[model samples]
Target: MKKISIQGIKGSFHEDAARKYFGEDVEIVECRTFRKVCELLDRDEVDGAVMAIENSIAGSLLANYALLQDFHLHVVGEIYLHIQMNLMVYPGVKFEDIQEIHSHPIALRQCSEYIDQHFGEIELQEKSDTAGAAQELAREKYKDVAAIGNQRSAEIYGLEVLERGVETNKKNYTRFFVLSKHNNPIAGTNKASISFQCGHYYGALAKVLTIFGDNKINLTKIQSIPIVGKPNEYSFHVDLEYDTEDNYERAIHLVLKNVSSLAIMGEYKKGDIELNKP
Candidate 1:
């Protein structure tokens, strides 16, 4: 069984993404932090790591991008998990009995509208993990507390669902990358993630982008990360997709001539977008 490292414990969205990508039988190694997940994979302690790269609503995880660069991990695969935040409480606890709600900050933010509408004046506390909050409420038998997480959390931690699908947006999804130590070519690779730094000159960035456009390569996503210790210098991380590999290669070749520190992060088949349901 291949062991994969994921941030947070069992029943968390990270676990959901891992199971979705690696199958249910894949062994899971839980880590409290994204850095730890990358460290375990970097040290060869696990076969792979599942780390969230971006969310539809919350934007990019900037620090995780730095971790990807610092650890030198390659993206071997990717998965898009539809987030289904729920309100869970200890068994037999009524919704009105809840005084404070706890969950990961991101989860809370996703459900902000739902929370504000129903939990006016109620104390809210941010926890390290969404499922961790649910687990705590279940394990400690906290009758006055409720947690916002997924339906899987209620099942894994033996809690009761007070409300299901509590997120403000029903279409919330998080994109996760499967990282590996080696950059092995994957079959049917139609998408790629790369990072590069352009020369500090006029239209340097535009020139690289033009190369892709001229080669018939589609630029799906582009994000700029500030270079450390450099006041205004930045590195560009981009995701590109193409109908043919030849076009992609030619674009990269031209892009290489225009950019510095060019790194091909990964080339893998794009994951299909599917909504996860309870």
Candidate 2:
């Protein structure tokens, strides 16, 4: 059984993603924080770690990107999990009985509609993790308090789900990356992630992007984050889906030839999305 490290406990989305990718029978090592996930992987304490890279509702998880730059791990695979935020509470507790709800800040923001409509008189408390909030509620046996988290959390903490898929947006999906100590040498027929730094000049970014355009590669996402200790210096994060044998080498060289520095973060299998049933 391969041991995998993930941030948070059994019910978290990270853990869910890890199970989805590695299967249910694999051994799981839970870490309390995201940084710890990277630390364990760097120390070879586990085979790999799963880290959430972005959420459709909240956008990119910048902290994970920072950890990618700091750690020597490489992305081996990608997983896209459809996030269904559920509002759960203790059994026999009515919605009107709730005085306050607690969850991670991101979860609270994602389910703003439910909070605004039902919990008008209730307070919203931010916790370290959504599953952690659910666990705390279970431990304290707070019947009047509800938690906005996943269904798995409800199952793990013995809470009853008051509502399912309560997120304001139905298209809520979070992208997670599987990180390992070794790079994935095998090629796949899917998207690629790369990081690069462009020279400080006008149209430098435009020129770098043109390489993709010229190669007929569809750029899916792009993000810019400031580099530490370098004022006004930033790095570009890009995602594009292209035929590996057809355009991988040429596209990389073209970008590297034009850009000051280029780093191929990883190329892995593309994520598949299931169509929502009405």
lDDT computed for candidate 1: 0.91
Cα distance off (Å), candidate 1, residue 171: 1.7
Candidate 1 TM-score versus the reference: 0.96
lDDT by residue (76-101, candidate 2, tens digit) is 78898888889899888898889999
TM-score of each: 0.96, 0.93
Please give the clash total of every predicted structure, in order: 0, 0
Worst 10 residues of 1 by lDDT: 269-278
Worst 10 residues of 2 by lDDT: 269-278
Residue-wise lDDT of candidate 1 within 1-278, one digit each (tens)? Answer: 99999999999989989988988889999998899999999999999999999999989998898899899899888899999988998999998899999999988888889989998878999999998998898889999999999877899999998888899889989999999998877877899999999878889999999999999899989998888898667799999999999999989987888887799889999988878655
